[model samples]
Target: MGSDGTTAEVRCVAAVPCWVSLMAHDLDVAKAFYGPLLGWEFEPGPDRFGPYVHAVTGGEAVAGLGAASGGWGMPVAWTSYFGTESADAAADAVRERGATLAVGPLSFDAGRVAFAADPAGAVFGIWEGPLGRARRLDLLGAPVWIELRTPDPFAAALFYGEVFRWDGRDPERFEVRWEHDRVVLRAEGHSVAALAREQAGGPAGLPPHWEVSFAVEDTDAALIRAEELGGTALGPAFDSPYGRVARLQDREGGRFAVISAKP
Candidate 1:
């Protein structure tokens, strides 16, 4: 990407959220639910990690959906992948920081990837490969934001900063800031994600996890449609500085959010 983070940036820069994927118990069901909700179409993806498909929108690969393997109790959820120059080096950094490396820096047709958990046990992915397809951020049916809900936002930021080398001078480098009581990660002079403490009234005993939000034409309308598809809304849409957002779970219990600029 150029220093300004414009469309000229063809490849995903290291330390930025490059992709998001949902591992579902049944891939078809996942697709069925999201296709109508997000206006996405599916295309086959590399099968290195089981049956996988890319969720496409407007001729762009927006996200991924994969069938969970060896999974009776596996939590259906969206996982975010951060771009990296070297997955092996990033894995080592994660291990050195008292974190857990859950999966491989395994090779695939596209690139290498690994799954790791932060100190607070929030799982995320590291990818060393081409960005494959450009994402339509903040548009209809596209991912608008990624977030980490943890016990300690500062500690989470520090761990990720070291692992991703956020301070480096790479074109993909990020600027970190504390804003409105949350740690925000910005790239190309725009906010990409945030780290915040788990809210007091959130689901009790739920562990820390990275959350992804998709843009919609209407937040409440999308939320009602989610319920029709067997998904549960954590609550009604609430206003944020950016827009109105509502968290919801898929039929399989995968959590995600839908937001709209209109209130």
Candidate 2:
């Protein structure tokens, strides 16, 4: 059970977000920019997907990058994938909740995978394999957190709760604090992700989306490298309870965050 009286029984059944992938119009430009900025080394994906590239850090696959093609009209951005016991079941649950399946419950050598968009239009994926689980976070270039910024935090929470079996009770359950805009999702008392309502007059031009944050040794230094690599800093680095954080956009305008957490 969870600490706040909500059941944690679903922790074993529902998959946590274990990987993130960035979709880019130009794969070469994406590689050139991220290779230096994040210290990511890329290798070709499995035989099924020829254009896919897996981002490796310290010899382990941490993320993925692939070309955006076909009728994929969304802007270039990172898509977070949750590990699931069965991608087909997860896809059914997403559809039952009124969310649209953007991709497939397609089979691969690694496992099954699918992409879906929430009712608010935030895209995410489901992965079923040992390779789909979250990698160790001891390295500086690993993802530490994922967040959803939507117009309706409450609705987003409810939607994810239904799909992922997350505890979404109101007032006292599953919140870091009642007044906090960010609602944290926990699995066995450990936070896995969060949903935040987009603030009025703040980056409203960007559509509802998921932002993946990678941990760094120094936020200031990382921000500098980002700028040097043709990326733009969305804002100056600032201290938070979690760490020093700054928002950044890739040269192609895909947004992400970097944080140097307090130890």
Candidate 3:
């Protein structure tokens, strides 16, 4: 049991994004930037990994912050973890499907985790453990959705389908509509995540990556606080069918979003 009486049961179905973690080039800057914006409180992670910090909101572990070491060469970004019954099996499936395994199906005090990149070069994770279900979208600071920005949405959908068994729209039916061209993934009839085609005339030099959005009470207020805390508002808040949304880049250049969904 956790300090909040939350059990570490795996509630999410297989292939659904269950957790979101940030790899920070500077942990201290990350704490300062996110703490005020999301009202997240930090706690030391499992004893084995000393530098890992778990982002807690309402006593629930919502996300994580870990130091990015040398040789990682990757930008500071949020990586989404999909739930799996067996990390080892998932890792094997990723390899067999032509995706590259970046890290381990190794175990820790909390659970088993492995990192991988799809054939299209978008990185993601697989997790199997007691705390795999620790995050809930209903929570104030929890991730409401994750979006994969890639140049090849069809290829990404097919790659993830083979690796994670995701049920997405048929490739033959794909169409780029609206401002954002994306395909939604569903598990057990519930929308889990999305695969988006890279937008034209957007920021240059941005690589294919997963973007995590947190649920907030007010998108406008969150964007204000983000700038005050050394982060930058990538764009003004805009209303959508789902909610008021805004994109933001942290002090360390990690990009994310905040949304206030319509009830």
Candidate 4:
């Protein structure tokens, strides 16, 4: 199991494809938020239902985007799902770790998926790709980055280390790393992962949730669009060493990011 009690192998898988399943409160509003912000083009679902967002990077369908309806927690934020080879096996590993099963490893018409909460309380998705996934590492773009914030960095590392068996760089920033890449659960400041872990932890703290981000040409303009779209700005826009950032939440209560960075 992963350190948080999900599939360690799945979590550790390198080059795991990322796909965002947006559960938006208002589809039209979300379209407005992303269309101009990310320059995405809308297309039919092929067989999926409603409209599927075609994420373009140099004008290619690198990923799929779609609005989620229902669920009281639905909001206009991006939710990240990692690609796995076997949903059932991954789910089994997660269960073995004493994790909470929120949804299915069950079959969807399109694919197989399951939802679970880690020991840190961050909720994540596991997807078994029946067909395929996207083709990009795609930094400096929409929601291309992820950061983990955990209370017990060592515990977090131990959990994840067991799951993915990933090993990597000695972080200049975080404590431990997977494949020497991202410092697993070792961030000191505020980060999307930290925020999610806090949220997932609950009332006294923040709930763990994915903070989906969008590519914006102007952070101020994106914040303006956020207000117009019935999405609220969670905090002031700040400049990260990496870039400029603003936090946001939509009507249904999903949180995400809008970032503008220097070229």
Candidate 4's residue-wise lDDT over 1-263, tens digit each?
A: 21222221112122232556665656666666656556665543322344444454444443355654435354354556656666777677777777776888876444687887667766677777543323333433445445444455455445544443334523432344333333433322222222222333543235544555655668777788778767788878888544577877765666677777646
lDDT (tens digit, per residue) of candidate 1 on 68-169? 566656878899989988999999999999999999999876679899999988999998986443355555887778888898899999999999887754
- Candidates sorted by lDDT, best first: 1, 3, 2, 4
Local distance difference test scores for all models: 0.81, 0.73, 0.75, 0.53
Residue 238 error for model 1, in Å? 0.5
Which scores better on TM-score, 1 or 4?
1
Candidate 4, residue 86: CA error in Å?
2.1
What is candidate 3's lDDT per residue for 84-116, written digit by digit as tens? Answer: 778898899999988899999878766788999
Estimate the Cα RMSD of every predicted model relative to the unseen true structure.
4.9, 7.6, 4.8, 8.2
Q: Using lDDT as the measure, name the better of candidate 2 and candidate 3.
A: 3
Model 1 whole-model lDDT (C-alpha atoms): 0.81
Using TM-score, rank the candidates from best to worst: 1, 3, 2, 4
lDDT string, candidate 2, 1-263, tens digits = 22222221111114467778888878898999988877888776653553567776776667778885565666778988877777888899999999999889998755788999999888898887743223445556767778888889888877876776554433232333223457776544445577888843456356688788888889999999999999999989988656788899998988899888777
User: Would you give me the overall lDDT of model 2?
Assistant: 0.73
Candidate no. 1 TM-score = 0.89
